[model samples]
Target: MLFVKTVTSFMAVQCVRSRVCHRKFWGWLNAVFNKVDYDRIKDVGPDRAASEWLLRCGASVRYKGFDKWQKDYNHLPTGPLEKFKIERIDATESCIMFKGFDYLDYLEHVEEIKFQRCIYIQDECLERLCRIQNLQKSLQWLEIISCGNVTDRGIISLHLLKNLRYLFLSDLPGIEEKEKTLQILIRALPNCEIKVDL
Candidate 1:
């Protein structure tokens, strides 16, 4: 019985060590993914560079004239350097943390953005996004679904996007007092169509 207990304890310790190692590895990888490549941006322009960053982080971007969403980081569409402008982004289940959001700053044609099951998007990310002047004028549609870190503060900050015509919120358990949030948003953005799901 002593030998059995010792072996079991050793096994548990090994398991814990392995899990910690695994977590550390993914954290390192995410950090790497978030690193901004300013040289790449200077060479390729904001739209193309942002596309690469989005795709690398498991997000998809649709170019202005494209019907299909570009998903593969390895097989991004090739064209003239800045010809393919990102018009919409779908960051569902993506690892797009705030550190990588600088890529989106200079994009001028982005009309829509979707954040679904994105684990790294917090209230600060929304605040930064809403403050971008380019997005403030150009973005017209926004969706946030199943992103647990987003709360009423994040939702409220989106009032800066006055051009947004449609906003969808669903499965966001972090948002308390959805009705009050909705009323505030409605008053702030009179023409916008807002939907909230509890």
Candidate 2:
């Protein structure tokens, strides 16, 4: 009886240790996927390069004149840079951390972006994204759903998107003052229609 109990306890500990090691490995792998390839950006142009990053991180991108999203990184269309300008992005359940946001710097035509159930999105990521000059002018629709890392500061920082017409925020546990954030955004961008649910 003692030997059986000891073996069972040892197996349970090994299983827990294995799970922890696997989780750490996946986290490290996602960090690697979030790395920006500046050389690739130069060769493929900003939109193509950014699309590669987004798709690699389990996000999807829609081109300027297209309705279907490009989800698979391997199946990305190959052509001239002008052929693939990223217009709308849906980043659902993606691991797009702040480090990969550098790819958004040169994109000139992104209009709509949605982040849903994304674990790696936080205040720094939002702050960095909102600071992009092109995005500030071009973005019209923005949605952040079920992103627990977004606090009042990050939500308030979105006022920088001067051209944003619609903003949707829901299920964000980090947002303490939802009404205050909404009021601030409304005051800052009067033309925008803001919706918030804490």
Candidate 3:
């Protein structure tokens, strides 16, 4: 009877240790995964093992300038990435190349998007963003700084975001007539605070 109790206690202690180890492993993985950007994605993109690791722990991953290096790599394994619970995406100082918006479709939980300094963001990218049903409903804040490629046509697509509250478009050279565009946006979204630096 004593041996039985001792064995049970030992098993309980092992279980506790295993839980602690699992937590520690996940914590470490999260820390490493959060640092993944376009530069590191190159190395992780080709390696199946690294991609798998990212897929498992990349729910909180924030890829700034993802479009800068995205063109260099072939399509990474996205099967497991579909399950990632990405909430915020920042692609500042990058390019939103052809069909680049398609990659964000899987992120159903995305709320905030920052494309500040993205020189390649154009009408096509905005069109793609408009098509995202989840983003249309859930997205609240959007920042597009110094994106000269985005014209009035591109800005028109953003009117579909019924829930958007904050819109920032600073130093956009394409917007030749800023006041007219600002007026149009204000009339369309009376509740939203739109900021533009022409």
State the lDDT of candidate 2 residue by residue for 70-95, as single tens digits: 99999998877798899999999999
Q: For model 1, what is the error of residue 34's alpha carbon versus the real structure, in angstroms, after optimal superposition?
A: 1.0
Name the lDDT of candidate 2. 0.93
The runs of at least 3 residues in candidate 3 whose Cα sits more than 4 Å from the true structure, single-residue gaps closed, are 1-83
Q: What is the C-alpha lDDT of each candidate?
A: 0.92, 0.93, 0.62
Worst-scoring 10-residue span by lDDT in model 2 = 189-198
lDDT comparison, 2 vs 3, better candidate = 2
Is 1 or 3 the stronger prediction by lDDT?
Answer: 1
For model 2, what is the alpha-carbon lDDT of residue 116? 98
TM-score of each: 0.96, 0.97, 0.58
For candidate 3, the 10 contiguous residues with the lowest summed lDDT are 64-73
lDDT by residue (1-198, candidate 3, tens digit) is 999999999999999999999988965655553343544335433223223333433212333224222212244425543343445656665434433344454345656777777655787888788788878877888888777788888887788887889998888778776777788888888888888767
Which has the greatest TM-score? Answer: 2
How far off is residue 1 in model 1, in Å? 1.2
